[model samples]
Target: MKNSKGGIYKRFVKRPMDFILSLIAIIVLSPIFLIVALLVRTKLGSPVLFKQKRPGLNEEIFMMYKFRTMTDERDENGNLLPDSVRLTRFGKLLRSTSLDELPELLNIIKGDMSIVGPRPQLVRDMVFMNQKQRERHTVLPGLTGWAQVNGRNCVTWEEKLSYDIKYLSNITFLEDWKIIFMTVAKVFKRDGISTEGMDTAEDFGDYLLRIGQIDNRTYIKGLEKSKKIAN
Candidate 1:
C-alpha cells in the first residue's frame, strides 16, 4: 500500500490513522447525515441511499454508496424516465451542495476508497478506456480527486484522464492536501458540477476516439451493427 509519501507509511500507523479519522468524522458529521437522510426519505419517497458498482483499486468492482438525490420515476411501460425529469429541485440542491456525496465517506472507512485519489468510473463506461488509461485503477478511488477539483464535468474525458495520469505520477502528501483544499473551495463555489446543458457529464466515446483508443469508422460500424441486431 502506497502512502501519501512515495514510501508506505507503517501499516501500524496508517490503518490506525484511517480508523481514528474516519471515526471522528462519522461522529462529528452524524447530524448532517441524519438531516440528509430525512430529507431524502421525505422528498424522494423510498430508497434514501443510492448505491452503484464502481471500480476500486485494481479495477475491482465494489458497491459505492451515496445519498439518494433522484427519484425512481418510471414511465407507463416500466422503463425509467430521463435523468432531467427524475431529478427534482431537491435532488439538484443535493448535487449542487455535494451533500449527495457524503455517504462515500463511509466507503473510506470501509477501506474501499481513499480520501484523495482519482475518482472512480463505472465499469460500463470503461469500454472507452484503453489498456493505458486503465492505470488509474492502480490506486484506490476517492471521494474527491485532482481532476474533479480541477474542472470535473466541465472538462472533456481526455483532459480528465490526463489529470488522473499526472496525479498517479506525482502522488505525494503535499499533492493530496492541495487537492483536498481545492476541493473545499470548488464545492463552496459550486464549480464544474455538471456539463453546460447536460444533466450529467457527456458520453466519453468521442473523447476515447480522439485519443486513438477507437477509430471513428470502426466505432460507427460497431454501433450500426449493434443497432441492427436490436432492430
Candidate 2:
C-alpha cells in the first residue's frame, strides 16, 4: 500500500507501459488475429469472437473478448452443449497455444485490463470470493497474470487466488516482465492448458461449495445472479 518501489511502478508506470505494449502487440499480431477469425468462422460458424462479462478493477463489469473456440451445438431441448462436447480439435489447439486469448490485447488498450495482473473472473463468481480474495480486483485484470504463469487451469481455484494475491502484494515492473516471459515459455510448452480429464477449469462457485466455503443457498444465489446478468 505504501509507495514502495513496486507501488511507485504500479502507480506511475504500469498503465502507460500496458498501453504501449498492448498497442504494439495488437499491431504486430493483427495478421494472426485475422487468420484466427477466419478459421473460427469456417469451423465454429459465426460469432468468431467470444464475448463475456467479467469483473474488472473494483469489480466493475466489462466485456472480455477471445477468439471463439467452441461450437454452437445444442441438445434435444435446444440448450447449449457442454464445453467438452462442443470443443473441437482446432479449438483445443487454439487454447493450448494461447491464440484464443489474443483479442484481450484490445482489452488492455481499452483500460479494461492490464498487460500483467490478476486474471479476470466471471461476474457471477464474485459471490464466492472472500474479502481477501476480492482484493484481486483492486487493480485491473490481465491478459496473463501470476496465477496463469504459475499453473493456470491445472491449479485449484484457491491456489490460483493465492498466486493472484501474491502478485498484487508485490507489484513491480521486474515481476511483471518475469511473469510475461514465463507465460511465453508456458505457452510454448503447452503446460496447464487444462487439468487432467477436463477441457476447462471447474466453476469457482462449485469449487467453493465443495470446499465448504459457501453454503448451498449461496451457490444457488450466485447461479441466479449469473442468469440475471446473462438475461
Candidate 3:
C-alpha cells in the first residue's frame, strides 16, 4: 500500500468515527460504567475518576480520564507510596480487564482522542519523545492504535515509536478499522497488560535507563523528519 499523505479527508473521516463510536460506547457501556464507579467509590474513596495530564497530538497537554484504579495511600512521611503498593486487588482487576479506560470515551467525544490512533503519553514521556517521537502527534491520540494492539506497554519505547511512525505513514479508513478489530481481540485476551519485570508498564524514566533518552542528535534528526512531513 502507498504511504498515506494525511489530509483533511483523513482527519474528517477519522473524527466522525471517533465521535460516533465513542458516543455509542458511552451509552452501551453505561451499566459497566456505573458498576465501576460504585466499586471505585466504595473501595478507593472520594474522587472516583483519575485525571492526569497527558500529551496529545503535537505534544499538546490534555487531561485524560480513567476510573481511579489506585489508592492515595501515603507513608509515614506523608509521601505517596509507589504504584505497586497503592495498587489493590480491585485495582488489578480494573487494570487487567481494561475497565479503567472506559471514561476516556468522553475524551473522544470532546475531540481530545480518537478510537484508533497512537496512545497518548504523559508530559514527561512526550518530553523524552523529544522531537522525533513528537511527530506521532500529527494526528489525534487514540484509545488504541498500532503500538497498542501489537505489544502495548509490553514493548520497549523504541519499538512502540517504530509502530507509531509506520501508522503515520500508512493511515487510512480501512487501516483504522483493522486496528480497531485487533484492539478488541487484544482487550478480550488482556494481552500485554504489563511489561516484563514490571508491575505495570514502568514510567518513562525507568525505560530510559534501558533505551536511553532522545538526545540532541536524535532530536535534530526528528526535526528534519518533521520538516519533511510539514513540507
Candidate 4:
C-alpha cells in the first residue's frame, strides 16, 4: 500500500509548489542574477552561461544551466585544459557562494527540474550507475538536494547515491523544506564546496574503475554508449 502522504505530495502538490517557489525565487533574486551575470561576463569573457546536457527524470536528457566559471584555454594539441586550470578565482567565489547555480531557476520554471530532489548528474555518469543507484532518477532532478546539503562534493559517490535514494524513499513537504533549509545553511557556511584537491566531484566512471567495481572493458563500453547517447 502507498503512503497517502507521499503519494499526495508527489503526484499533486510537488510540481505546483516547485513551479511557484522557483518563479518567486527568480523574481526575488533578479538583482543577484544580474550582478553574477555581469561578473561572469567580465571575468570569464563572452558566453556568461554554461550549458550542458544532464540526466533528469528517468534519465531523460535536458540542458542544465550555470554561470560560466571557467576559461576556454586549450593546450598545444588543442585539447581543453583541466578544470583546475580553467577555473578562476572569480569562478571559485561564484561556486562557493552557490551563485553559479542561479540560472537553474529557468529549468525549474520549465518543468525540467524541481527545487528539491536528487541533483541532476552528467549524462555520461549515468552509464556508471547501478540499478539501485539509477532509482535516483525516479523524480525530477533538483538544483539542491539531499546529498548536496549533506556533503555536496565532499562525500564519496556511494554515500551521495545513498542519500539520494533515501530522499526518493521519503518525499514530503516537511522533508523537502528541511532539505532546502539545510542547503541554505550549507551555502552560508561554504561547507563541502568541493573535495580537497578537486575542482568538482570525481567522475563516477573513474571512481567505479578505481575501485575495481567495473572492469576496463565495461568502463570503455559504458563510455562509448554514453557518448552515443550524449551525441
Best-matching candidate per TM-score: 4
52-148: candidate 2 lDDT, tens digit per residue: 9998887778899999999999999999999899999999999999999999999999999999999998877776788888988888999999999
Q: Candidate 3: misplaced stretches above 4 Å? A: 1-9, 210-231
TM-score of 4: 0.95
After aligning candidate 2 to the native by TM-score, how far in Å is the CA of 184 from where it should be? 0.6
Q: What is the TM-score of each candidate against the true structure?
A: 0.85, 0.94, 0.87, 0.95
Span of 10 residues, lowest total lDDT, candidate 1: 1-10
lDDT of 3 by residue, 92-176 (tens): 8999888999999999999999888888876555545656667788878889899998899888888998898788877788888
Assess the local accuracy of residue 189 in candidate 4 as a C-alpha lDDT between 0 and 100. Answer: 99
| Candidate 3 residue pairs in backbone clash | none
Q: Which residue segments of model 4 deviate by more than 4 Å? A: 1-6
lDDT per residue for candidate 4 within 1-231, as digits (tens), equals 122335888989999999999999999999999988988888899899999999888777899999999999999999999989998999899999999999999999999999999999987789899888998888899989999988899999999999999998788999999999999999999999998888867899988998999999999999999988888
For model 2, state the Cα shift of residue 214 in Å.
Answer: 3.5
Ranking the candidates on lDDT from highest down gives 4, 2, 3, 1
User: What is the C-alpha local distance difference test score of each model?
Assistant: 0.78, 0.89, 0.81, 0.90
Q: Judge candidate 2 against the unseen true structure and give its global Cα lDDT, from 0 to 1.
A: 0.89
Q: Give the Å error, residue 24, model 1.
A: 1.8
Ranked by TM-score, the better of candidates 3 and 4 is 4
